[model samples]
Target: MNALSHKIIFFLFKLKLLQPSESTINFWLQSEDTDKLEYAVTQGNYKTRKLAAEALEQLAKPFSIPALLKCINDKVQNVSIACLNALERISTKDELIKTIVKKRFKWVNEIREKREKFEANKGKKYNIYRWERASKKSFDMVKERLKRPIR
Candidate 1:
């Protein structure tokens, strides 16, 4: 699309009148306007947030990483998934580790550990493995990706 059309669409999106499709997000991702993308990711509705996450996957600016990390704990599942996909797409092993350390999983890990300890002490041995397993898996995937040369 032409610049004018792109601007109009972006304006509409900002007004919350338009829900961005993947193509619209792809167009925006290629734009130089990082602020708009960052704003949408942080404050927009679920659809916009998801689109912003998708855009971030392609753009992958270091400044956008923290915003993307915040989205991982979004109340909306799709938004969270999109953020995760973006993180996986953009982050190197070291970057992923840094993000993990920075977030500390925002109390998620602490909660899991407490729960596990409580369950173990109670002799029930709760099997809530997914939480820790997913974190480990993400780290492992990043490590594996780091071993390969980017095409």
Candidate 2:
């Protein structure tokens, strides 16, 4: 391609107006253009996102960990699954991604549906075993205090 067209395409990438093909995404990955791959994981159509996630999984680069974490909740189940697979692969293949997952995303170990369910309920109040807010200690004004310590 001509330099002018390449510059125009690079501009489009910056704008995220271009719907990249799998090859284009692969090229970006090979060239270590992680910003583009991260964008692809979060922005592109389901197919593009799936492919990008798969590529990231194969690459298993630590920097892609945060992007893959964000993509794990993709509305498309397949894409989310791809994101999960990528995260698992990354955790296994890269120590940094692994440490981050263990420290911050332990729930990623759950199955996708279960993870989503857990995440959904994470903020809700539930009456499980021993689940109660501590009540403030109160005193009755009319109640007389013990005169002295009990023998």
Candidate 3:
């Protein structure tokens, strides 16, 4: 983090300046250096990525999807949430959304099932049963309704 970058991060954090215009966001989105923008997506700083994610909605070109998907692995929960929102902004078709949702459902199901088992072992209910059910539904939908294109 450079001095100027640190200053901007601090200022944005302290003032709760959460939204930036499309052009201001483009400054970062279009820059040769993506380190700062990548950092914002992964830093666990909600307000920063909250702004960046909104900007991502507008700055999206073909190159943005993979980078935005990378955010889903962020250690911060909110960053992952923001990445999902950003995906929604970029996805145009039901299939693309469905594909991503299917992937997310797989992840959520694996995680939630393990957590649920752990909770059950400890004689407690889990917080994610609803999500587990939804994941199952999505999985079924993908398996049954998502027919492959005819050759």
lDDT of 2 at 73: 72
> Scored by CA lDDT, what does every candidate get?
0.75, 0.73, 0.61
Task: Tell how far residue 143 is off in model 3, in angstroms.
Answer: 64
Q: Residue-wise lDDT of candidate 1 within 114-133, one digit each (tens)?
A: 97888879965566655567
Candidate No. with top lDDT: 1
Q: Give lDDT: candidate 3, residue 141.
A: 85
Model 1 regions lying over 4 Å from their true place: 93-151
**Candidate 2: deviation at residue 14, Å?**
4.2
On the 0 to 100 scale, the lDDT of residue 136 in model 2 is 23
Give lDDT tens digits, candidate 2, residues 13-77.
66878777766766766777677678778888899899889888878787898899898777787
TM-score of each: 0.54, 0.55, 0.41
Name the lDDT value of residue 57 in candidate 3: 58
Error of 3 at 147 (Å): 77
lDDT of 2: 0.73
* Candidate numbers sorted by TM-score from highest down: 2, 1, 3
- What's model 2's TM-score? 0.55
